[model samples]
Target: MDGNKALIAYETKGGATEEAAQKIAEILRSKYQLEVDLVDLKEQKMPDLSQYRNLVIGGGVRAGRVYDKVLKFLENDLSGKRVAFFVSSAQAGTPGSYEKAKIKFVENTLAKYPKINPVATEAFGGRIKILGKTVTDNRDMVKVEAWAEELGKKFTQ
Candidate 1:
């Protein structure tokens, strides 16, 4: 594995998760000087994991469930890699339900995968649109960037 390389793999429905992945990739590359690769899970079901030492996986929540693609990806053997996980959900964005959303979508979900111990995990706000018009948008790019910065430090260590 290349210690200097990182992979930001994500699956999105309304684009919030993809945006978060991009922001994370930007911070890891520009601030940490880490070589980062962004992959959309929808396009690539399986990416060659042998080349990266750090892996960041992200997904979106819909109908109260994390994206299936991400869950499926998690089934892969991730041993010896610095893994991080994140999810984008409307509940996560709302101040009242953020903790619950984190528990349900991040904590509880990861609990099922006992073999994959992530170095960091987070739940970010999501956007909902109708007819090409945004109806609800709670995404915070600043928060995403901050998380990325922290992840960069961890990845390097």
Candidate 2:
């Protein structure tokens, strides 16, 4: 609700996207001294976009696409906002699949919202498990924190 505040709205099917959102929020709050609000998209309550100076929307990759709630949230008016986009996917950590993941998750979202120019767009590593067996565990806290720090610089400047 303050100009120095940031809102990180995320859509998560599992918990990887939520983990990324929390990491971003922690970085912004501790390192950048910004008040942050972490909102789950399924909560059904959207914050007033004009209230915060920074907005970060992210979600996990499902079937090679971002969550529908995330897409719907982006459909709102985002003019005059310092926005950032991030996505969590196992493909993000795979050398051969990283670019494709970025295209599918980040670039495609940009294509949909041509009017909104994000300050930063990132594709972070994510974890996935089936039947309690790890399929991939690529979630990297360092990368996520660095991206959030970059976002802090963008918002502050």
Candidate 3:
């Protein structure tokens, strides 16, 4: 268990975060031929950080913060690691109230892990709308998958 592997974990409330995680995993796999593992915060217990060399985390932005599980998981043992984080927010391009909230979420999360050398950390745009048995305005997982592939390029440099 050397610290050279890549791990991607996520907590998605309405499946958006999971979609982003899958995209990131595919990107790393297809571009760099890297073996990335996806850990669902809800389904699995937290894994030891020392077991991997690289780590990526993503979760849903709810109310004004990352999902509770993601917050708790990354709070511990994030020092001296190559890490990246992302949140799936309902707000994509507009710097509105939700956007600021997302930024705060990132800020607070990063505050806990000051030593993380993240090459990239940003919120994936769009959201999951659930209202009375209807849905609208979901971000495309395909794009995230492609972006994840592109983001992997960061590791090469």
Better of 1 and 2 by TM-score: 1
For model 2, residues 1-157, the per-residue Cα lDDT tens digits are 4669899999997789898899889888888888898999998588777888889999888787889999998988888889999999889888788898998889987898898889899998888889878888988888888898899888778
Clashes of 2: 0
Worst 10 residues of 1 by lDDT: 39-48
> What lDDT tens digits, residue by residue, belong to model 3 across residues 1-157?
4443688888987887887787788778777877788899999876777777677888887676778888887776766566788888776434565567556767667777666667677766655566634354546666576557655666544
lDDT of each: 0.95, 0.88, 0.72
Name the runs in model 3 displaced over 4 angstroms.
1-4, 93-102, 131-134, 138-147
Model with the higher TM-score, candidate 2 or 3: 2
Q: What is the lDDT of residue 38 in candidate 2?
A: 90
Q: What's model 2's overall lDDT? A: 0.88
Pairs that clash in candidate 2? none
Candidate 1 TM-score, true structure as reference: 0.98
User: 81-135 in candidate 1: lDDT tens per residue?
Assistant: 9999999999999999999999999999999999999999999999999998999
